[model samples]
Target: MTSVKSSAKAFVSEGALSEIVVKIMDDSVVEFLVGLGFVAVPGKEKETLSLIAPNQEFKVEVFSRLRDEGICFSVGPDWCPAEVFEFLRDQKKLTGFYRKIVWEGTSTPKIIENC
Candidate 1:
């Protein structure tokens, strides 16, 4: 008999925000959030997220609802109304910013730097 190791796959809903718990050594969370129009501002032992959503109403609603939640939401620019990649580039902080680019007939997605 042979023993095989299996791992669970992570999936994110299309056009929706995916929440995740951050680890102490995890620094990529901030970059991921920035791509989704939510910039992570440093806080006391935590991060305060500023969302650039579709409209003021949406921003207010989301911020108010998730203000106390200690979760990082992953979102892509296609699902968001803000040009997060451009914003990061313009701000000269595109060091870790990445974008998912899919090629023709390729089922797998490639993560490329947003420079």
Candidate 2:
């Protein structure tokens, strides 16, 4: 995984209560996700983050930040908690959950979206 040396910008979701928007300052989001203890979903694109589960507090913190920031987006069903993710990881013998990040692809890479 890439190292997370640059700072991260957390954006509040405008409509979505479940998803949170975190602006990745570095070129890669993989590092940021790894730092958070979330892993990429198997058989899926690393960019298309999918985790086993995320707790309500974790969800709320992200969603709330995005909402507070006035970042608008489509809200979906509530995400499962971290415990659930842990269970699935243990049962399925999976590595970890996925964390999505949107890259700007500019000289100074900046994240556009985070899930």
Candidate 3:
């Protein structure tokens, strides 16, 4: 059977609709956090994440070692918060793109470019 993706119009519950809507607005928040170099793995329950950016260079350092975690998080102006991508790009430690290995079933994260 084919998988059904989540749609924008879908609602999980009537009573939780408002919160769900808010969550949708920040759907990419997790991805953005992950892209910044957090070891955000799937199947792990997470309520909140603290992105530790001690310096500008380490802002995106999370992505550098995240490949070992087998994570696939979203990014881009269309999918993620625009400011987030910009912040990650601003960090000299991080390259523009990193490999997504879990769904792609790869052993490495690809570096797209230098920011």
- Backbone clash numbers for all candidates listed: 0, 13, 4
RMSD (CA, Å), each prediction: 13.4, 13.4, 13.2
lDDT tens string, model 2, 64-89?
33334323222223543223333334
> For model 2, what is the error of residue 5's alpha carbon versus the real structure, in angstroms, after optimal superposition?
24
Between candidates 1 and 2, the one scoring higher on TM-score is 2
C-alpha displacement of 74 in model 2, angstroms?
5.2
Report the error of model 2 at residue 10, Å.
Answer: 12
Which regions of candidate 3 fall more than 4 Å away from where they truly are?
1-45, 76-92, 95-115
Which scores higher on TM-score, 2 or 3?
A: 2
Best by TM-score: 2
TM-score of each: 0.23, 0.31, 0.30
* Cα shift from native, residue 79, model 1 (Å): 9.1
The local lDDT score (0 to 100) that residue 24 gets in candidate 2 is 28
Which is the winner by lDDT between candidate 1 and candidate 2? 2
Residue 81 lDDT in model 2?
29
The lowest-lDDT stretch of 10 consecutive residues in candidate 2 is 10-19
Q: Distance (Å) between predicted and true CA of 10, model 1?
A: 7.2
Which candidate has the highest lDDT of all?
A: 2
